[model samples]
Target: MSLNPSPLPDSDFTASGRRVLEVETRALQALHDRIGPDFAAACRLLLGCTGRVVCTGMGKSGHIATKIAATLASTGTPAFFLHPGEASHGDLGMVTDADVVLALSNSGESDEILTIVPALKRQGNPLVAMTGRPQSSLARLADVHLDVSVPAEACPLGLAPTSSTTASLALGDALAVALLEARGFTAEDFARSHPAGSLGRRLLLHIRDVMHTGEDVPVVAADVSTAAALLEMSRKRLGMTAVVDGDGKLCGVFTDGDLRRALDDEDTDLHATPISALMGRNPKTIGAEALAVEAAHLMEEHKISALVVVDDQRRVIGALNIHDLLRARVV
Candidate 1:
């Protein structure tokens, strides 16, 4: 058996980390001050797109392109990332005339991407180039150009794309957000695009969307035996069952915890008692149209998992528990 360790560094890792931060921060500031007509024109071009915005790049530019695509998709612009190498390899078929292509390149002359320009043009898709070298071939060939040039590289060798890539990422964020505002994109719209996200499911899902309805609801007659009500609750597996009166209107709810408290009564007659005798009157009722997340908050506030969904007449129409919220990703 053997254990080997590399020699310790002469410099502290913390100091190196701080240096990287300082470099990136400077890069961002440079990008912020560099915004001009090109940036605005880029947003305008994307805002005018009638179809999907396709992002493409090579190497490090690909990483930035992927992130930019996500931001655009979440912000209201329909977008996706395409790999330059893959596109040249036949994946280019995914692009169409209705789409706009956003190409990223630090040198503005990546060969893998340059190979696809002719195909993109033949398809009549407009090109918006993001590059540090505005005078390079890709930028010159573009219908719109965004300059993400930086003053210097953070890399000590002045070769690795450190500051330059940071600038590109920041510029991409600026462009996405600008287009988002121009399109009147909202948080709710963003949520709709990201339905599985916490904010999306919370704001977009309703009680009726997740509540157990139809035959899945657990209900008991107002006079049903404690044992019978408990059986219904157990059968439904929602931890609670609504107790309704002769009018078919909700009168109370019986929960597992409530049953536990009732069992503690020395005189409790479980076999002979009606559910109404141990039910919670005027139980919290949620409307079908109410947001499921709202129901979650109400449940948290009241310290209850399940609630009866009722109509204006208080007739139980549905039932939901915290488990439902968890399933819906709204918890």
Candidate 2:
């Protein structure tokens, strides 16, 4: 007998990988079709809940459950994760009568989770189970059962978790997003939860929060010489100065660039030429409460790098530059 070596190229290995991705993608699409009255009932149960949603699972499923719990918690739903192994120890104390338990298991036979079911029931907590087998032990005792079965594992040996875990994670995402939509949560609401993030600065940070106030604001009288405005701009290190009339209301803005154009005119005298002659009339202004992102947008639209925050009387209360927005992460 002659032994023949396999002749399949390396591309065949990648072909199998592509097949796996296609199968998993179809499994997620099927999950969308499988959503039914049970999904709606699950939402209703969680909607009226006065307590936290307790997410629990084992192995890879546990990782997905933890992320799901975090999404629910951050988006206005009170939730937390409980490792089944820890629950059998003293962690069961975290469960209460007001809490609802969400359990995840591929076989629905995880011993760690089974050991804590009795105690959970004794506390009057409702159980929501996610498993591939509807006839599984955990599913039998569950108040709501979400089916996340796949046709088969993507692994050629059919031993490792591939399609099933993907289905479970997708289902968890669907549930959390459903709750988010039902609550009518807004970007501002999300910004509150993520107050330390860039999104928060864009939505919650106002012009007053980052604008230079008091002595740092470059200010000069409208009648001040163009030469004097340059001195004020340099002293304040802002490259620009606000020109105010005798009544102390902002009338225009003068910058180093404007002074350059005036200096090119031989008739213009640096010491005698009025600041108003080189000032830009109708400068853009913003309110203190306006979002810093809005200020940035206004700056870009007007082709300027700074803004003057004014009150109802159009007096400069504060100032900000492009660098300030970048530092604040409002850009």
Candidate 3:
């Protein structure tokens, strides 16, 4: 046995890549041009759905179906993917009268999918078929048939599911996005579906949710000595302390950097100097109800590591440091 290694010319590689893209682009364009009453009907079915969109397919179509299901689920439509083979076995129980079944098959003649069609019909679930063959059995039985026909496959042999699959996937996306618009799904709704994601943290996690409250907040009275403020900063371990007036309204903030700048003056009296003298007046503060990302942005803009969380009255209610955002994964 022997191996011959021959690297293709860069031009050949680039040309091949370009050809594949052009073919897929044309397939999508065909789908876009064909969108009409059927696509609108599919969107209406999804929008009117009282239950989940159960997507099923076979082979390469199955992979595309899973992604379409995910897109639908995240965009405010409750949806899930079911394997056609599994549905034939016992997973058909997952379908209900209120559910909508989205079947995908480029050939529209998948045996696995066809095996489960009667049950889905008997269950009275609305079926939306995405197939390249509008006259196929699956399309004939469908309540709404979305044509995903393509001129040719990107594969050199024209056998593999290339252009056809791309067209089907694009149609799936069109359905999901159309339903999303009709349903008025917003980014906040998307964030709710993705609670563990970064967008969720930015949208849902408020400063108060992650900031140190009550005794955990480092604070020093306006008249407190610099030495006392340093002690408060140390005990809180936040590298900063809020300087507040008698009413607890935020007057200023004192940080380790402030202390260092004060110390640079050889004649400065660290022990007897009032913290208010060394504190930064009108320090940046964020409301407790503001998003945590706002605090992170403030810190970045001011080149500081912490921010004072205040109430509507500008009274200190909490304090947050860069570490707090890190620990909460809000940053």
TM values, all candidates:
0.78, 0.90, 0.91
lDDT of each: 0.90, 0.88, 0.91
Compared with the true structure, what per-residue lDDT tens digits does model 3 show for residues 96-120? 8899999999989999999999988
In model 1, how large is the Cα lDDT of residue 33? Answer: 87
Any idea what lDDT model 2 has? Answer: 0.88
Q: How far is candidate 2 from the true structure (C-alpha RMSD, Å)?
A: 3.7
Model 2 over residues 1-331: C-alpha lDDT tens digits?
A: 6589658798998898899999898888777888998788788778767999999999988998999899888887889999999888899998889998989998888888888998998888888898888889998888899888888778788888899999998998888889989999888988898999888779999888999999999999988888888999988877688999888799998876687788788999979988998899888889999989999999899788888788899888888889999999888
Question: Candidate 2, which segments miss by more than 4 Å at Cα?
Answer: 1-17, 263-267
For every candidate, C-alpha RMSD to the true structure in Å: 4.2, 3.7, 2.2
TM-score for candidate 3: 0.91
For model 1, residues 1-331, the per-residue Cα lDDT tens digits are: 4477636575776677788789888878878887888778778888889999999999999999999999998898989999999998889999989999999999999998899999999889999999988899999989998888877788878988998888888888888889888988887888888777789888999898999998889999988899999889988999999999999999999998999999899899988999899999868889999999889999999999899999988888999999999988897
Ranking of candidates on lDDT, top first? 3, 1, 2
Model number with the top TM-score: 3
Q: Which stretches of candidate 3 lie over 4 Å from their true place?
A: 1-4
**Positional deviation of residue 221's Cα in model 2 after best superposition, in angstroms:** 2.1
Q: In model 3, what are the clashing residue pairs, if there are any? A: none
